[model samples]
Structure formats: structure tokens, C-alpha cells
Target: MVGERSKQAFERAKRVLVGGVNSPVRAFRAVGGTPYFADRGEGPYLYDIDGHRYIDYLMSWGPLIWGHAHPDIVRAIAETAARGTSFGVPTELETEMAEEIVELVPSVEKVRMVSSGTEATMSAIRLARAATGRTAIVKCIGCYHGHADSFLVKAGSGVAALGLPDSPGVPQSVAERTLTVPYNDADAMEKLFADRGDEIAAVILEPVAGNMGCVLPLPGYLEAVREITRRYGSLLIFDEVITGFRVGLGGAQARFGVLPDLTTFGKVIGAGLPVGAYGGRKDLMALVAPEGPVYQAGTLSGNPLAMAAGLTSLRMLKRAATEGAYDRLESYGRRLVEAFCQTASHCGLPATGHAIGGMFGLFFHSGPIVDFETAKACDQALYADFFHEMLAEGVAFAPAQLESGFMSMVHGEAEIEKTIEAMERAIPRIAARRR
Candidate 1:
């Protein structure tokens, strides 16, 4: 229930905020309802303004891996804020954060911090262009690499959620430089590269394809992309902004044994704070300015509070990994998706799901959902009904079917049971509506 208070809040926000929300998806446009305003979150539960508590599977869109308001991250942010939030000068905290990332991620030899995923990706493309001396970049259709102009041509997530084909402001010439191929289709990528290999500077993709739901790479798909990019003399850039630390300790690169020339990261690395990073081969990173020619600078790139929170979160994850926390997370996701699919089937509604580490997707369609084309074929109306009913059952999934559901370390067995119980009840009722 988005209570009267939240409704009023939205009404008030509409006077000041664009579409009554800072982000388009948050407005609940895709789900066809007013959004509930979150008051606070604790562990895996979010409390809304109406005093409703829901088990949060969205987890702030995949950043709250340890769940909300974890004491460690909060304390880190508070302590670093006391020291000062930003100085416009580099801090040792930033260096330590960089070292932690370089140590953990297989593809990154050196890193440059930025304030947002968009910054990391935009800067990465610039560096790729400068290093390869080519203007064209290749990206997968429906694989979102942030909101950088070049990436919006065939983006997913909010762009798909809002039903926008492509944004208006990006120049056609800029769009032309960004070649798009269907995800999980190695031959399409190969054909494109074969046709215009010399014009391509880089091939960028979400290694796990989180944007168009939690789509996995086809067997040998990532390796094929890597081989093609290498053969074509184009850089391979993995946008791990959503999957970075969430999928595994070393990200998709370490998990899949495929390394890219450059990697971009966000979400879990910042521990619910605003931060992003791009790093890879030392020679390529050397091209970023102050050390080389490609110019990219941000005042809050390495803000102490973000660095502290991120470092604390990473250290926590690293320790937890040693204790099989990630294994448990993967298990939780698997169990939940299995339960969701089973329940949907029992209710005589077709459904499919995939769970990889802490990320999962539930689709109202029979699936071997390999790419965006298949992903878009899911039942949007059924999902929207299921979302609202699940809300009524006191569980929170992503507002739209296109988004991925995240599991946190704090989503214990009890929470998992609670969610399944909610789904068992919600699914049949929603399915009945569809019938």
C-alpha cells in the first residue's frame, strides 16, 4: 500500500520533482501505480511512509549487498564524514580503495575513480577511442552501460521500463559511431566486426547482462566476444557496474575466466554510496590525463566518505567470501527462483527464472531467455499484477519485470521462507487475474 502519506508526498514532489521522482522507474510508471516512499530500511526489510514493512528484494537496485544500514558501512561513512567529506584533494583512503579493487578484480591493473557509473563508462569509451585511434564503439543491444550519450541508442533498464526507443538529445552521428548487436549472439558481433573492424575502438558489454534482467552470457559467448575484439584490434570493455562484486568476489571476469582490456564498476563497490571506477591494463590507464593525454577529472571522484564506505564494504565482503557467504547468497537466489517458478507453474501460469550469485530474474514466460529479444516477450501485465500483489503480501520485488531482483547477505533463511510464503499466496491470486 502506498499510503495517503506517500501519495501526498508524491503529490507534493510533483510540484518540484520531475515526474514526481528523481529517477523515472521510481515513479512506478512501468508497474502502473504510485510508488511507495521508503522511510527507512533495516537489514533486508524496508519500511515505507505508511508504516508498511516489506522484505526488500530490490535492495536499492543491487547495491545493498549487506542489506540496508549495516553498522560497518554506516560507521565508516560517519567517521569519514567527521574527518571531512570532500577536500578536492586526494586522500590515502582513495589509494587504499584503489589497491583493494586492483587486488580483487582480475582485469584491473590500475583504476581511476569517478562519482557515477555514467562517468566511469563515458571516460572508459574516451580512453578506448584515444588509445585505439578510432571513433566507433560496439555495444550489445539492450545492454546498458550507463546514460552516456553513446550508450543510450539501444539501452535497457529504465529506458525500456519507460518505453523509450532511444533518447532524443543524442546526435545521430554519435549514435552511428556506436554499433549495436544482439546480446548472446556471437555471429552478429563477428559479422559487425568483420565489416568495420578498423573503425571500432572498443566493444563494451555487461558481462552478465544485468540491465535486460539478469541474462547470462551464452556458453562461450563471452570468450567469443573477447576473441573477436582482440582479433579486430578493438578493446573489450566489461561494464560490471551492476555485477561487479555482487556476482562474486572477483566479478564476472574472475567467475567466467574471461578478462577484458578495460572494466567499469559501480553499485556494490560503493556500498550504497555514489561511486564508480574504471581500470584495466596499465598502459591503457596511463592514457587518462595528468599522466597522459585523455582528460577526465571530477572533484568528488574520491570523496573520503565514499572511499571509506566502499573500503569497509569490500573488506567485509572479502572476509565473508572466505566464510562461504557468496555461496550462501547464490544458494538463496537459486532457491528463491526455483520457488517462484514452481509457484507460477502450480498456478497454471508459465514462468522462468535464472539465479546467479545474488542476482536473479523471474519472467512470466517459458524461457531459455538468452537475449533482450526473448526477454521482452515476457508478460508485462502479469508481472505488474504480481508485483502489486506481492507488495500486498509484504514482499518487495523490482517494480518492473525488466529489472533484476537482488538478494542480500542479510536475507537469511527465515526471510527466504517469508518471501516464498508471500509468493505462494500472491502468485495464484495474480495468476487468476491473468486468466
Candidate 2:
């Protein structure tokens, strides 16, 4: 059913919006088609402008952990909106959110809200520079923090999909302060510290690299990073924007049992609303105004509607954690990935996949995708074919090979079974096209 209507809308959008999309990934360039214009999402399904209903796996790019348009979150937003929207001043809901985050996340002793993931990371880096009185930051090559000037160099996700190692508009002087190293390489990290340990202000990374197709860190990689950062008096930042509550109530830091000095969060925390947060030790956080010299502020940082939605989502996640939601997620992920692997193998196509919690990735023509380079080497054309086939069969996936897919609490036995069926039907068509 995704036919003329969606295509017409995209054609019109092209005249007004650059690439016919606000975000680069939404244009469906990797999949070689016009992107479906979503009308609305309910439960586990997305309804497109062309009247097609698809069992969604992208989950709005990793938010909506409870699924789209959950009653609780919607109701909370409605009730909060009736009171007031933004005050440009503190509210009780803001304090409650901060308390909830600090209590749940292992590394967050005090938290500050921001309007988006970009602001959270942008402010966190500034705070690190102020605390350490150093200018340099060490970031992993494939991990994406945000669109900040420093993070745009060798970023992953949409940037990687475009095959641009770095973006323009970033001055060489600003980019030089950011040192890039490969993920899961502890020896390289050690060498960097040995050479410029004193000049480095912080080391920031996605503990679980979701930007590069859900690649997990190797054994002892996080522990090694923690040790190195501590040895050199550099702050360690875990960018949990995608992994925060989606992985577990305590996030990847607690799941892996390696705590960082600071943590940045988005996605699940907002429950599909626009929000982000950064927090850390009390001493370091206090340095942000009006307590100390490091100044960071946002007018809409703690908007009431966003706070209500976030609070509801966090409460649901807490309840789910108590009721073994993570266990359910693991079971569902395993079933879907196993089914896809079996189908791909039967078609004589090399494939490997991995999943944890509610996030998963399927790499085409892969041995093992452990790092960004290995992840990028995946057969993108085959992935595009599979994506189109799956869409035709009423299953939605992340359009780009480098982006990971997400499952929500609503993705139960029925939806997972249906997705596996769709994959089985789609994989052979993709393989036949390759032949």
C-alpha cells in the first residue's frame, strides 16, 4: 500500500526540505526509495500515508521502549499540558526527574536536563574541559555523541551511511582537540594515554556502540578504559543516549559493571519526547552555574510536557525491571535473530547477528562485526534489497545497514513470529537478486 501517496508526499517535500527529510537517515537513501510518511504509530505498528500498516522495529530510532503511543505516557502528557508548558524556571517535576535518574543510574549523582542529545553532550564536554582545565577529548572512531563540532569527526550512524569519514563546517583547530581511536582496542587507548594523557580532559564513548550496528565492546575493553582514564585524571563519559534504560534500568554501565565519571542519556528517558540529560559526581556537576564557573542553561530544558512523559516512562521501566522485562526482551531478540540467521543460511548467504536486551543487528555477508570497519564492510546492497522486501511484506526495519533496530515491550510472541516469517520470505528474494 506504500505507493503513490507516500511517493507524492516525498516529491513535494523535496521542493521544501533538503533531501526531503529533516534528518539525513529518514530519506531512505541507503535503501534506494522514497521514505514512507508516517501518519501515526500505535502499539507495535506504524501507519503510513499510503494506508500501509507495518510492525515497526526501528521504534523511532530507539525511543518508545514501551511502544508507540502508550496510554500511560500519552495520558501523562495530556494531564501535564493542561497545567502549563514551559516556565523558564524550575518545577517540582524537574527535581523529581533528577532524583529518579540519580537513583537509577549508577554513575549519576546529580543530573541536569537539556533539550536534545546534542546539547547534553555539548554541555558535558564543556564541563569536562572546565573541570580538568584541559582542552583535548578522546572519542572512539565509530561512536557518535551528537552533531557537535568535535563529535562530527569520524562519527557513525547517518554520517557513516553517507560514507563521509568527517563532516564540513568544523574548523581544523577545533577538530584537532578531538583524538579518534578504534573501539575495543585497549592497546591503542593505552598508547594514547601514554603520549598525551596530561593534555586530555576526558574520554567519551558509547559503551555499547549502537551507532555502528549494535556492536558490543570486547571483554575487558570498558574496564581498561576506566583504568586508563583514572590513571591520567581524565573524566570517563559513557554516552548512554541509546542504551540508557533500553538496555536495563541501570543502563550499560551497570549491565557491564563498569562505572564512568559522567553519563549522557536520551531516547528511552524521553519516551519519544525531545529530551536529554547529563549527570555525574556531585563535585563535578556543581561546577555548572549557578554554583561555579562552568555555565550551561536551556530555556526549555525542563519543559513540563516532556517531564511528564519522561517520568511516566521511567516509572514504567522501573516496574518492568521489577517484573523481568529485560528477560522477556532477551528471549524475543534471540528468537528473531535466530530465525533470521537460519533463513539467511538456507539461502547460502553469509550472515551474523547479535542482540542484547531489546536492540539487535543483522549484518549481511559477515564473519563477526566487532568494530566500525567490520560493520561498514557489510553488504549494504543486499541489506537494501532485504529492507525493501521486508517493507513490502509489512515489516519495518532501520533503512541503513549501520543503524540498529529496536524492539519494544509491545513486540511480543505474535509480532516476533510475524517478523521472522517476513524475514524468511524476504531473505531469499534478496539472495536471488544478488545471484
Candidate 3:
């Protein structure tokens, strides 16, 4: 329950914080209630400031794969912090971190570290343009690649969650360079490339679209896009900020056996710290500064603390992967999806969901929800009702219908069972309310 203290805190926050929250979705406008301010988190659980404990599926919006405050990760951050927070000088830790990524992800032979996913993505596109000598870039219609000006046009997630069509400051001229095609539509991608092939520098997409509600790629969709880009002399860039390590020991590319020319990463790599990276073929990444002509630099690009935390998380995942951890995570997610769909069916409410690796989505639509156009048709009001009712039953999902729900490695049978029961209890309340 949102207690008096949390309500008061939100009231006070409104006096200063924009929309009473740092992030728009955190304001809870989509879900229609006051958002709970997090006090702290433990394995698979988050405690709000009002002394409420709920099984957490948000996982800090897809970063906490190890769950909150794992001892190894905590120790790594602490030890690195004690040595000195940030040093302008280079450190071997950065080299080791880069090496780990190069070794684990199949397509990345070189990397440029940045502080956030937006930086990584924007930097990658700049490199893509410089390499290809083309000014135009193409992105999937509703796949978000962070908040860079080029990405603002037809973006998803937070932009969708808050009901903002598109950000105001992105110039129409910039938007003109970005071509949009519906996700999972191979023919649309092919037509777009054929029509504008010479003008396009790159085509960027999420291998598994995380933004528009965890939608999966259709059969051969990624392969088709890869072929189309290659045929047109445009680069293929996968924005794996949410799916990177969360999807597998390698990312979606390695799992699906389809490689992109470039990849962007954040979330899991940072292990709940502020970090992001973009890496690719040696020749392309070689175009980045100090190594080549294109210039992009960040003073805190490879901060030791973030490197330590991320490196530790990656190492732990490498070990756990051999132990069948990824399979376990996928199984747990499938169970939740099944339970959600089953209970909704029993209550005579339409519902559909998808789960893969550590990410899952719950929707108030009967789905074959492959693209944003289809995803948007879900019953928003029903989702909002289910969202609050589940909260009252002590389970926390994403505040918006369009966002993906994440599962962590630490979420085991107990948490899964509890969440499913909460779903069962919460579903009928939502259905009955409409009566």
C-alpha cells in the first residue's frame, strides 16, 4: 500500500522535481496512481519508502539481472570506490572490461565506452555515417534507442509511457533523415532500403524489441533486415541496451546466430551503474578517434567504479551460464506468462504475453503483437486496473503497459509462485470492476 509518508514525499517532490519525478513514467500517469518511491531493494524484492515490500519485476528497468545489491557486485564497487572514484588517467580495468566484451560478444572487436545508452547510440550512428559517407539513418518505428535527437522521432517506452508523441526540440530536418518502418515487417524494411539505399548510412534496431512491450522478432526478421542492409551498403546496428547480457551470456545476436555490424549496450553491462558501450567490426570501430578520424570523447567514459561493477557482473554471469541459469530464467518467465494468460482467460479478460531469457511482457490484448501498431491496441484501461490490483496484492510490474517486465537470476521458485498467485487474485478484481 502507498502509505501517508510516501504520499507526503510525492507532494513535497512536486514542489521541486519535474512532474514530481525524475522520469516521466515514474510519475505514474499511465497507471493512474501515485508511484511508490523505492527505499531499497534485495534479491527479487523492492521496499518502497512507505514500508511496503513487493516482489519486483521491474528490476530497475532491466539492469539488475543479478538482483539488487549482490555481495560480489557490492564488494567490487566498494573496493574500486575506496581506491579513488575517478581518475583522469587511463586504467587497466577499462582495458580488461573492454577485453571481456570483445571476447563474449561475437561481433565486437573494438569498443568506445560512453556514460549512458544515449551516448553509446548517438556515437555509434556518428561512426556509421562517417564510415558509410551517408547522412540518413533508419530505425524501427517504435524501437527506442535512447534520447538522442535522431532517435526522438517515433520513439517508444518512456516517450510512449507518458503519451508524448515526440519530443519538441528534435528539428523536422533531423527527423527527415530518420526513416521509419514497422518492426517485424521484413517487406517494409526491404522496400525502405530499396527506395532510399544510397542515402542511408545505417539501420538500427533492437534484436528483440524491448520497448514496445517485449515483442519478439518474427521468423527470419533479423536475418532479413541484415540482408537488406548489407545489400544496400548500409550498416546494421543492434541496440542491445536491454537485451545484451540479460538475454544470454552473449546477446541476441549470438543466440540467434545473426550478427550486426555494430552493437550498443548498457543496463546489464553496467550492472546497475551508469555505463554504456558501442562496439563493432575492427575497421568500423577503427574510425573512432585516437584510432582514426571520427571524434567522440567522454572524460568519465570508463570510470573505474562502473567498470568494476560491470566486469564483476559479467564474470558472474559467465559462470552462471554454464550452470543452466539462462534456461532457468527463461523457464521462470514462461511460467509467469502462462499463469497471467490463464488467469486472464478464466476471468474472461483478453490477455497475451511473451517471455524470453530474462525479459517478459504482460499485455491486456490477445496477441500476436509483433509491432508497435499491434501493441498499441491493447486495452490500456484494463492494464491500469490490473496494475493497481496487482500492487495491492504485493506484486510490482512496470507502471506502463508498453514497457517490458524483467526477471532476474535471483528470482527463484518462491518469488515466481507468489507472483503467479498475486496474478490469479488480482485478475478477477479487474474483471469484476467492469461489472
Candidate 4:
């Protein structure tokens, strides 16, 4: 049950905000309860309105690698704000942030900052089409690249959670220009390019799919896509909005040793601020203005506050990486996965999961949740029940099954242990209800 204050707050919000929230998934539609309003977050825990606390694995949808309101990040933002928020002209802080991205990401050489992930991806596709002289693009099914018109077809995340595969407002011709293929299926990708190779400006993907429940690429899947794109003279775009810096210091491309032509980043780079970026080979990025004609611009492209906070976060990550911090996050995620799997097994219910670096997924399916079709086949109702039970136990997973669960540097042994115990208690009750 939701606390009264949160319930009241939601009712008040519904009169003004769309669906009582800006985002659809926050309505808790999948879980069938009043969404708890967050009051404050500290370290690994989020305190909700009406005074409920949970060990938060949501991690603000994969940005808070150092955890909520981290002192360094907060101080950096405060110091930057004292100076100024935004300037119509350029700032050195933007350059510093771009330099860090270029250094850390495997594919990015020259980058352009934007206001949101949607902007980063939308601009990347536009540049790709201009460079290739083609208007068509390919995107992995269930791999969301923000809410761009070209990406709304067969998208995931909130769109999928809301059960709207393709939104209404996007035109039919626009949707048709965006081709789709099942993720982790190189053969499907090869086939698509074989038929429409000349038309495809680029193939955009989440190298490690986050929106479709943290799905990992099949072995050699990324490599095959890279080869196909190279042979066809098409660019490969890795949508690393979730995986960048969260999966590793250099991201999934570094982890898997496959480099795309262009990469888009958001969540971790801004450290939870509303920021995004797209970068690629110098020659390609050279085509973007004021260097060339394919124009995309934002007044808040490099807001100083975002730059300062992100710079501080990335710098801290660089130090933490030296201390094997990413490995620790992976280990912690694996423990939660193990606990969830073990309890489901004890209850004779189907369960499977995967954890990589700082991201994990819990599925109410037996095994091998490779793509959207398989992921959707999982027992969603059962997941909804389990979700609420865990919430009651003070462990907050993503509100829906298709979204990824995030781990943070702040979540330690104690939090992990308590979460495991919570799962142990919650799953059995859910199982009993099913029986």
C-alpha cells in the first residue's frame, strides 16, 4: 500500500501534470499501486514521501553511479552555479567534459553536446543520413534510442511499458524509414542490410540493451554488426545512454572490443542532469556545424552546472576505476541476481536474470531472455506481484519488468545483504499467492 501523503500528492499532481507524472511508467501501471513520491535520496537509499525508505536499485534510471546526492557532485554543481548556469557563448567546462568523454569512450573522437538523450540520438541519425546520402536508418527492436520519430517504431522503455508499440503522432512514412531487427541476432541484421544496404544510413543499437531489461548481446553479435556495417559502408551507432560509464570505464564497446562509428551518451555523463551528447570519427563529426552544413544546436547544450557535476562525477569514476570500482559494482549486482534466482527456484517458479558491471535484470521467465519476443514472454503478472512485494520489503526495483535495474558505487555489503533477505521473504509470499 502507498503512504497517504504520496497518494494525496499524486492526486494533486494528476490535476496538473500528464498522468500525474511527466513519465508514463512512473504511474506504476505495471505494479498496480499508487507510485510513491520520492522525498529525498542519500547514498543507496531513497526516502519516499510519507516516510518510507528503500534500498534503491533504480539509481535514477542509471545515472547515479556514485549514488544519490553524492557530496562531490553536489559541491561541484553548487560551485558552478555560484559562477553562472548557462551562457550563449562557449565555456571551457564544456570542453573539459567533451575531453573526458573522448578519452573514456572507445568510439567517440569529436563530440557535440545536447540537452537530452533524445536530442543526442535524433541529431546523430540526422548526421548519419547526411554523411551517407541515405534517409533510412535501422534500429534494434526493443532497443530505445529516446523518443525521436525515427525510433518510436518497435521501441522499448516507457513506450513498451505503456503498451504502445508505435505512437500515434509519428507519420507512417517516417516509421517506414526506420527499419527494425531483433537484437542479438546478427543474421537478422545481415539479412536486413542485404536487402536494404544502400538505404540504411546507420544501424543504431544499445550494445548492451538496457530498456529491454538489461539484455546482453549474444557472443560475437556486436562484432558481426560492425563487420556488416563496414562492408556495406553504413555507420554503426551505439546508443550508450545507459551503458556508457555504467558498464565500464570505457563502456560496452570497450568491454566487448567492438567499436561503432558513432556513439550517443546521456545518463551517466551528466550524472543525472538533463544532458546528452553524440560523437564519432572526426571526419564525420566535421560535417556537423559550425564546421559544416548539417546543423543541430541547443542554447543549453553545455549548461555549466551539468558540466561541473558530470566532470566531478567522471573524475571520481576515473579514480574509482583505478581501485577496481566497476568490478565491485558487478559483484554486487551478481549477488542480487543470485538471490532473486535462488528464491524463485525454492518456490518452484520460473526465474532468470543477468548482471553486468552495474546493471542487472530480474525476469519471471525460465532462461535465455535474449530479445524482445523472449523478454515479453516472461510472466509479467507474476513480476508485477513480486515487484510490489519487494517494494513492501524496502527494496525498490524498476517499476516495470522491461526496465533495467541499476547498481551504484554506494551500495555496499550491508545493503546487498538486506536486499537478499528482502527477496527471500518476498518471493515466497508471492509464490504462495500463485499457488
RMSD of each: 0.7, 0.9, 0.8, 0.7
Question: TM-scores across all candidates?
Answer: 0.99, 0.99, 0.99, 0.99
Q: Give the per-residue Cα lDDT of candidate 3 at 135.
A: 95
What local lDDT does model 3 show for residue 107?
97
lDDT by residue (tens digit), candidate 2, 1-435: 368999999999999999999999999888788899999999999999888999999999998898999999999999998998888888999999999999999889999999898899989999999999999999998888999998998899999887775888999999999998999899999999999999999999899999988888899999999999999999999999999988888999999999999899988888888999999999999999998999888889978888899999999889889899988997888888788889999999988887888898888855688888898889898888888999999999999999898999988889998999899888988888778
Count of residue pairs whose backbone atoms collide, per candidate: 0, 0, 0, 0
Q: What is the lDDT for 148 in model 1?
A: 83
lDDT of 3 by residue, 1-435 (tens): 677888999999999999899878889898888888889999899999988999999999998999989999999999999999999889999999999999999999998888999999999999999999999999987899999999988899989877897789889999999999999999998888778899999999999999989999999999999999998899999999999988898899998989999999999988999999999999999899898999999989998999999999999999999999999999999999999999999999889999999999999998879999988999988999888898988899999999999999999999999999898888988889877
Better of 2 and 3 by lDDT: 3
Off by over 4 Å in 2: none
lDDT at position 358, candidate 1:
90
The lDDT values for all models are 0.93, 0.91, 0.92, 0.93
Q: Show the lowest summed lDDT stretch of 10 residues, model 4.
A: 157-166
Error of 1 at 82 (Å): 0.8
Q: Give one digit per residue, the lDDT tens place, for model 1 in 344-427.
A: 999899899898989999999999889999999999888998899999989999998889999999999999999999989999
